[model samples]
Target: MKFQIQRDRLVNGVNDVMKAVSSRTTIPILTGIKIMAHEEGVTLTGSDSDISIESFIPKEEDGKEIVNIQQAGGIVLQAKFFEGIVKKLPMDTVEIEVHSHLQTVIRSGKSEFNLNGLDVTEYPHLPQIEEDSVLKIETNLLKTIIRQTVFAVSTSETRPILTGVNWHIENGELNCVATDSHRLAMRKAPISGGNGDKSEAVIPGKSLNELNKILEDTSDELEIVITENQVLFKAKHVLFFSRLLEGNYPDTSRLVPAESKTSLTIGGKEFLQAIDRASLLAREERNNVVRLSISEEGGVEISSNTPEIGKVVEEIQRKSTDGEALNISFSAKYMMDALKVFEGAETNIQFTGAMRPFVLRTTSDDTILQLITPVRTY
Candidate 1:
């Protein structure tokens, strides 16, 4: 295969596909990137069995040539060396050529590197997904959904199902929920162009995070297709595929409380700041626990204590307090994470009880909700 392409475009394509490449794979070929040059464009693919990413650079876009294909062929190059070489190329154009016996040469502006290329036939085949029913969502909105929910997925391998986010679609709305059993995050958004049928999939949080990093924040829509074992996301010039988790995701609907015994309305920034300061002392504790005390007279206080160290108490004013006065203890880290994504001027917190899970959301938006299971300190 021989191709001369714009160096910047090649760098971007290499970077995007490298997200799927892993050096620890059992298959040696998986450590390299598969490059194919065709009449239309150049395609780069990387995979490590669990996830696969493909990026295409068109030969001509907007009447400007991006790739000039001298010959149509394919080869696999070591991702580690190829990525580094492309990024440091001195010129705006790069040339790649393959000769007999799987030998490849890369040249750009007075610098040249020869890499041992693997046979393209040795690479594993990517899953072939049939796009019968496709779901479309805005690029930025999808990134937001992943960011808001993926963080709550369980990091422990004890319950493998909780390591992924549960995705369910009904009535053209997509609901994403993730939880580690201590904290839960849920987000809902309207989608378009599905089969008009109910659908559910459990996507691994790691894969979603990688996909989110590659996707640009834009209003352009991306197509999504779900199969029994795979979910595919297709954006302009890029295709991402992730294997679905095998087990059923636990039902999280019942975890949210029906009503609250204590409710407080406060500014999100102020609440976040207070929790941050209180966590400074709480970090030394086992669970980084912080205590919050609310009074019937609308007085709010956040405090934390460590026996060997010191105690921190901060009195923060609340906009309004209703229901019964209560004292609660929870992980300050969890509260701060929830507040960062809540994203509004006012935050509404509803507590079922001192030990029950509490819900946090913006007063203006009900679609995004964060729940934290409080800790019990006797």
Candidate 2:
């Protein structure tokens, strides 16, 4: 197999596929990237049995040629070495050729590297998914959804299901929810076109994060095909597949209170910055807890204490305050995470009581809301 591709294009393709490469795998070939050069373009694939990413560089994009394929063949090359080689290449183009006996060679500028390649036949076959169950979403919107929720997913393996983001589509609305027991993030958006059929899937947070990193064009839409155990995100020139978590995601709708006893409307940035500064002192504590006290007449105050490292107390003028006064303690890190997701000028926070989970959202928008369980400071 032999092909010449623009150095920049190949570098991007390698970077995209490398997201799925695992160095420590039972199957050695899984540690490498499978490269296939065909008549249309060159396809690069990487997988670790859980998440798989494939990037295709076509022969020509627009009026320029991105790749020229001389011979059609497939082989696997070590991802670690190939990634480094492509990035360091000092030229406008890169040439890859594989000879008999699995001898692979890479050349660019004044540098050439020869490495042994694995037979493509030994590579595990990527899942073949049907398009019967498919949903389309804007790339940027999907990225934002992942960014806003995946941070709340549990990093612990104790409850494996909590490590995934739950997605459900019904009545032309798509909702995504992620929680780690302590805090939860949920976003709801209207699907441009839908049949109103209900479908749900729990995708691993790690996979969504990786896919979000590779999605470059927000204007482009991607199709998602769901199977019994797998979900596929099909983009313009990239295909991402992730295995769905086995267990069901816990129902958390009841966790959000319909009414609140305390409410405060404050600037999102100002509130987030206050928590950010307060966390410095709270960081020394085990849970990085910060206390928020709100008064109908005195506005809101954020404070944190570290016995040995001093403490910090700051106040942000509230746009409006109502209901009962609140004295709540919560993880500073969790509050910051929720605040950063709010892009609007101000956010409204509601507290049912001192010990209840607080919900945060923009007053003008109800599509996305975040819930935070306060830490008991007794």
Candidate 3:
């Protein structure tokens, strides 16, 4: 196989696919990237069994040639060395050629390097998803949904299922939810052509995080294909596939209370800053707990204390509150994460009681909701 490609174009393609490449894999071939040159363009694929990414660089896009393919074949090159070589190539173009014995040669203006290449045939094939059950949404909106919720997924592998985000589509709305049993983040958006029928899937948080980084926030629509065991995301010239988590996600609907006993509306920025300052003191504690007390005079007091570190106390004016004064303790880290995604000027936090889970959301927008389980502190 032989190809002469624009250096920058090749670099971008390599970087995008490298998100799926893992350096420590039992299968040695999985550590290499598969490069295939065809009549249409050049394709780069990286996979580690759990996730796979394929990026295509067409020969001509917008009437400009991006690659000039002299031979049509495929080769697998060590991802570590090939990525470094492509980035540091001191020329506008790169020349790559592979011999019958899988010896790869790379050349630039004044640099030449030879590396061992493996037969592309040994690489695992990516899952072929049918286009039957597909949903389309704006790329920007999809990224927003993932960003707001993926962070809440559990990093621990004990439960295994909690490490992935739950995706459910119904009534033309798509709901994405993630929780680590302590805090939950949920986002909802209208999906084009999505129906009321219930369809559910669980996708790894790691996969969604990588997808968010690669996707461009634009008005362009992305097609999502869902099957029993695999989920596929298709952008303009990129295809991302992830293996779905096997167990059933916990039913979280019942966890969100239908009504609240104590509700307070506060400025999102002010509340976030209060928590930030309070967490500084609580960081030394195991739970990083912070306390919130709603005053009868319509003000909220935020405070945190540690045995080794001094306490912090701050007050923020509230928009409105109902019922008796409420005092609650929760993880400051969870509160800060939930507040960062607030889209409006102020957010309404509804507390059922001092020990119950509280809900935080924009009063103006009903599409997003965040819930945090209170930390019990005597």
Per TM-score, the best of the predicted structures is 1
RMSD of each: 0.8, 1.4, 1.3
Task: Report the Cα lDDT for candidate 3.
Answer: 0.91
Task: Report RMSD for candidate 3.
Answer: 1.3
Worst 10 residues of 1 by lDDT: 278-287
Which segments of model 2 are wrong by more than 4 Å? 192-195, 296-298
Native RMSD of candidate 1 (Å): 0.8
The sequence of per-residue lDDT tens digits that candidate 2 reaches over residues 173-213 is 88999999999999997665445578899999999989999
Extract clashing residue pairs from model 2.
Answer: none
lDDT of 3 at 261: 86
Error of 1 at 209 (Å): 0.5
Off by over 4 Å in 1: none
Ranking by lDDT: 1, 3, 2
Model 2 lDDT on a 0 to 1 scale: 0.90
Considering every candidate listed, which one attains the maximal lDDT?
1
lDDT of 3 by residue, 146-236 (tens): 9899989999999999999999988778899999999999999989754345789999999999999889879999998888899999999
